[model samples]
Target chain A: MQERTVKITNRLGLHARAAARLVRQAGQFKSAVELKREDTGQTADGKSILGVLLLAAAQGSRITIRTEGPDEERAAAALLQIVEEKFGEEAPDGLF
Target chain B: MDSSNTSHSRNSKLKGLAASPGIAIGRVLRLDERGRRQFYYMEVSAQQARTEIKRLREAFAEAHARLKEIRSNLKGELGGQHEYILDAHLLMLEDKHLIAEAEREIRSRRINAEWAVRNVADRLAGAYRHIKDPYLRERSADIEDIATRLLTTLSGHTRFNMSTLDQDVVIVAETIWPSTVGELDLNHVLGFATDTGGLTSHSAIIARAVGLPAVVGLHEITKNAGTGDAIIIDGAAGEVVLRPTKPIIRTYIEKRDLDRERRVEASVRSSEPATTLDGVRITLRANVELPAEIESLALFGAEGIGLYRSEFLLLNRLPELPDEDEQYQVYRKLAEATGEHGASIRVFDLGGDKLSLDGFEEEKNPALGLRAIRLSLKAQEIFRTQVKAILRANSHGKLRIVLALISTLDELRDAKRIIEEVKRELAESGAVHDPELPLGVMIEVPAAALMADMFAREADFLSIGTNDLIQYLLAVDRANENVAHLYQPLHPAVLRTISHLVRVAEKAKAPLELCGEMAGSPIQAIALVGLGVRTLSLAPASIPLVRNAIRSIDQSRVRALLAEAVKLATTGEVEALLGRQLPRQAPQFFAALSSLG
Candidate 1:
């Protein structure tokens, strides 16, 4: 298993579009990817947009990404990179 | 289960809003989710459970395919701006939690596939309901949307096969989503009668675009009618009759044929200018709520978009308004669509009965409370953002800014000050914009109407919103059933106020327009022209009939009729006079109007 913790830096955190992007990235790896919100202790499947949205991971919140299977390491890295990059969203001042 | 075969002794009639005009008589096709829920919980044996699980899987797959097709089709139509919405729906369909949970419920709870899916969706929706953020909470609607699609698929309601339907049928549903309207085959579907909807809903707009007769807000059409039950819908009268007797059906059939013949005659002359027989020219424009409705303007021979209600863009994204870029894109589209003819974009008219944003205090009477320009002035940032967008979009084509509900001169001046400030900022930033863009005031409040001469002097143009003006002038809420009868457009007081506005605008040499339900009605439209108003903005579906009415009248004669009308004491007196006199002057137009009854 591969696990890493990342902070949600985007202004509108884990919104529908952001969650969709996360799910799309998670689906690329042949691994079971899960996201656990550190503050609330809530867990959701990273590949499920609804589950990710239900996590309610707002901005400045910490979440741990876990991936297991043959491609676990790559999946964990990809999801962590997505979160660290704010899911390719522009800066806070930019229009959503 | 055989509800269609049930004896039809009780012939019921329902009254609703006239969403789209015309008539339709056919058997009903009940797409009622509530009715389907009754059979959702039926249990099954292990052997049947296997089949049910397979059925569930197939439904998910089929729904996924249909959504994919819809997404691709809409890509070209909407310029892929709303692609993310459909993308999320497709993702929800294939979500592991949704699919696996349904399968698990089917096996362990021994419930039918429909019940299992519904159960899981309800639980998730409940969770979403508890969300603290209003924007995120709104996402729950997306879940419900997908679940409805799955349920429809599992119940063998094949919305995808509507194009191949073997018989002409009237669609009876609790609510018809706009996306579903895109999938409907107009050739097979005669009309739409929904238990819930309004005249301005997206579905109703599509129905009008395709010339389908629709009566919405029937409240219980689905409960009263079933698949294959005889149904008759009179859209103009806002009447829906279920298990319609032969006489009722015959009356509607004749009315329907007359409506069709009249529509064909009107369309043939739609390209001609709306000039009175006496040679006075009148410009007819469309009141648009959505960008999708832009396509219907040219088809209806609308000169331009008169009232682009920008507030609709705020409805879906409330709590968080659409950013400047998003608003700019929509306004640019409107400007381009209208082109040289020009378009008027009304800034956010939030509050009132239309919408109450999150964190707004509950008012005792919202209609009279802080709304329109009042709300916009209070939330200057929201107002500035929309103004900035409109100004930026003005570079694309001819566009005017219209401020709504400017009851006081100070409010109009304040809004104009904000627009000027925004224009300065845009110019400083070196953004492309039209510095000469016109600013208009919507004369809706009784105070504004009484002070029309002052507003006409200050504002570049004046557009009378008769709906709210009459409601306020008479102290009658049109939406309230008790006092709705008193919400008269042709009341003597309303006519006098309008005539006052006309004289004031003419004296000021300011362009004047009227955009309200009264302008859409043939009788009231003639009265408007008679009152000296030269431009009218109405629904796209109403343009043909109103144009035909305008072409049929002699303006000088109607002006004389108006002189007699304002002297009348009551609404009934004025209505009787117009009803008696208008027919004589415009026999063909009155003939079409009488046939509607």
Candidate 2:
């Protein structure tokens, strides 16, 4: 199992578009992935749009990326990267 | 006007169609047409949830079809962007989170699919609303949309799915279709009131035939009705009182108690033969459809199943018809269920208006076209399969196969010949079957009634299907609301035809049974009994009322009325004669008939 915590730096937080992007990224890996809010401890399936949106991880809020199974390392790395990239949204600095 | 009286006092009386006749006061089981279900799913059992899962899947399929239709309409007229949204909507129909989550809750939490769907949607909606992003919050509307569609489909199925009732209660609905009424729980559903339909509608006919008290055409009753509001339905008076005052409720209770006492009194006669006052014995039988109805016959203490429609095997059985073995199983089940009492299995009466078989072309006027025995004869292989299967089943139990729609002597002869051929084939093959299987004809057409004597001379017995007889005799389609009034059972021509059939069948000493909606009515039963037609087969639910009607009858007086009934000029005169004579001769029967309305 692999886990990582990262702050949501997207301008609009973990909104529908960002959640969709995250779900698409997580669905690519052959592993069971989940997301949990650091503040509320809310859990959601990483591969589900509705589930990810339910985490309500706003901008600047830290969320934990947890993955398990044979591809947990790659799955956790990809999900963590999407959060760090601000889910393709334009950040305040406009830097990747 | 003879129906069960509740209390003399009444308030807020609402008139509707007198669909079914009975007196019932119960907590309302209202279905919210708006799909705003207020109930929770936590108490639903696993079995219920299992059904709910199936319902959810059905809702999905329904949504797919609806979305596809919308897309088809939006084709070319709308741009690609709208089509993309529709495609997404269709995809959401199969959303694992939306459907699978609801299924999980149904199994794990033991809640209904509707409630679970709403629950999951609510939680996700709450999260979506909490999200600071406007885009994510807007997605909540999509979840609400999907939830609404699923709930609508679930509610739609239950509105007509009468088998889901866990307890006896009055059904309060905005409107009910004839087909929906056909699917209701005949045994448990005490009565119903709808926002539409009149006395001659199919719902009313079925309700009256099944002996359920109903009041229809009560517009907006569903809006005011709740899940368990106390309701009083006066089917006889065509009135319904919702949330009645205490005094009115007390009066209804007294009325219901008295009716219950009378029912208890009637229980003793359930085991007795359906003999009238003059020692004229009658055979009270049931019209069997689905094989499961055999239990209902036994429950109602029916002497036998008179009209077991074998066509039910072919109708709606697309892709593949039941082979000889499947047909044999159903035939055997009915025969065994009937016990010592005989089972009459009508040959497949497919084609025409009933149902179209493979390769059978739809006719311009199906009722007058090739149907029943005509279609069976044309499709000899199909007819032979049914005959051979019936013969095979009779070897196990007391089963008699009757040929339906024998319009002419030639058709009867041909049908008889086929039966002989099947018998020979069975003999040559040394197959186990009833060798001496007696064949009969269903006397529905005018030609059959006219030749009742000739047919009875050779045929084993005759069952008069008055439903078809009256319709054909008057040249009126009883199902057509426009001509429904002309589809009178008391038409002078019909009474003469029935009187002739009874006299002929009696002189020949061949068995006879009147199996139709006509025989279900206490008033009509009196007239038929008076006409010297001793055997009556009708809906199983109507057995008690018909039996009570038969017991109350003085055969001698009815026989006298019959003599005058035949001399009557019009259908109105015949009705007037029976209406005046029945209540006077058999007040108890008339009172019971009042309750039947």
Candidate 3:
């Protein structure tokens, strides 16, 4: 199992497109992926768009991703990379 | 449905209308979805549970297949953002929790897949109801859409069968959606003759783009015709002949060939100025709602947007109506799209059978109740935000913001006062706006039409909304089927009202245009022209047809017809005069729209 605590850094928060990007990248791996928001304590299936939407992960909100399976490390790393990259939008001003 | 079976008009003709003009004769394909819903809930046994679960699995596969087909079809056709939205829906179909819940419903409750899918979808959507963020909650509609597909598929819906088309077909439905119109086999579709939609309906726009002969706003068309029945559609004439005899088919085929040539001629001549034979130029502006229609405006030779209905901005934006910034973004895009001609943007005319704004409760009689400027005045804050947005957007390009549904003199004054106050506040806040920008009133209700001089005196311009004016004058709701026949624009009262308003506008020297479905109709437009209405605003699809009607018409002939008709005793007599005399006077204008060989 691999775990990483990453804050949502996108300017528009984890909106429709941003959530879609996270879900799509997460679905590429074989690992069981889940995202838990720190404030709400609501866990969402990282590979599920609806689940990710339910997280209501706004900008500056911290979330932890836990992945376990054959592609655990890659899955965790890819999700963190997507969040850090701000889903290809400019970094939310204070995030860096 | 039964009445449609009995009432086949003379020559087997069914008069609907041509929203998008062309000609076609093909096998009728009845694509009706309304009567396919399940009503009864049957009890399921423990042994039957396994089969129910299989049915649920089948539904899942079908949903995914349908989504995959739609996604693949729309792949290159949509923007990256729209494509992402579809991908998110695709991901949702594979969501373990959603599927698992459906499985749980079947196993434990022993309900049918359709009911179980709907039940699960309702529960999921209910979760979204309390959320403060409108955007997040609006995503709930996506879930409902998927669930509808699941339920329909489980109920053995055969609506999505465009994958194989061996023969050319004409689609007949109550209403065909614009988005789904692309999914239909466009290459083989001879034309679509639907039972609903006006010239400006979303489906009509798609029909024009795809070059299909589309006749919308027919009555009980789906109930009248069946699959494999021969259909002859005169799209320009808005005529349909269902189950025609062999002789009739031969005649229609000959007519269809003639229509094809005429359509080509019309397309080439669409760019010419709409002027009468005596050299009176008519300003034909397009009534547009969506920004997508902006491109079509230039193609169809629209002078400018006569009515840019801003209510579309109020659709599905939650927690509140769209703020000033959001509205400014869309209005700015509209400004750029309009180029030199600019647009007449109506303020958000909410609260009338429209989606509730900021959780406004649904009214019993939405149309007559507090709506348009009435609602805007009460909801001053939202109205001010919208006013400021429209004013701010004028800096990008010229735009005239019009207030809707102004019945009395006071309502017009109240609106003007608020607009001026907003302008002053913007100036104080150091935001730029066109203080000299034109603001107009939509002369819809009878009171405004009667007091046309008063409204003309107060506002810079006026656009006659004959759709609402006729409906209000006749005390008939046009949408209500029971009263629809009574909603006549050719009524003696309606003509008198129009003539009175025209006379008033002329005396005041107030520049006004009739922007309504009535003006879009060649028959009604000729009458309006007779009443001295030079500037006519209509749907983009109707511009060429109306232009053709106007160009060949000598102003004196139509004036004579109007003079004779106005003195007629009844609506029927007036209509009789219109039906008889106008065709004789302007033979070429009627001939332009005719497909009859």
lDDT of 1 at B354: 72
Q: Compared with the true structure, what per-residue lDDT tens digits does model 2 show for residues B14-93?
A: 77655565578876665433332322222356677788788778888898788789889999887753454455456567
Instruction: Please identify which of the two predictions, 1 or 2, would achieve the higher DockQ against the true structure.
Output: 1
CA lDDT of B316 in candidate 3? 39
What is the CA-based DockQ of model 1? Answer: 0.44
User: Model 1 off-target regions past 4 Å?
Assistant: A1-96, B1-7, B10-12, B15-19, B26-211, B216-222, B244-258, B359-364
First chain of candidate 2, TM-score = 0.91
**lDDT of residue B206 for candidate 2:** 51
For each model, chain A TM-score?
0.95, 0.91, 0.91
Model 2 residue B128 CA deviation in Å? 29
> Which candidate wins on lDDT?
1
The predicted structure with the larger TM-score, 1 or 3, is 1
Please give the TM-score that candidate 2 achieves against the real structure: 0.63
lDDT of 1 by residue, B1-597 (tens): 223345575468899878788898887865535422322234456876788888899999999999999988888776644577888899999898889999998898765677777878888899999988777898889988998888878866422245434578898877775435544566888899987765554556557656688998787676677667788888889899888788877877888898888777777778999999999999999988766689978878999989987887865456787999999999999989999998999888887767667777879999899888898899889899999898899999999989998889999889888888998999999998887789999998999998989998899999998878888899987655445567788999999999999998988899999998788888999999999999999888889889989999999999999999999999999999998999999998788677766
Q: Over 4 Å off in model 2, which ranges? A: A1-96, B1-19, B27-169, B172-190, B194-230, B235-238, B242-247, B290-292, B296-301, B311-320, B351-364, B481-483, B506-509, B587-597
Q: Judged by lDDT relative to the true structure, which candidate is superior, 1 or 2?
A: 1
- List, residue by residue over A1-96, the lDDT tens digit for candidate 2: 999999987777876667767877787888999899999888988877677766777788899999999999989988898888886556555522
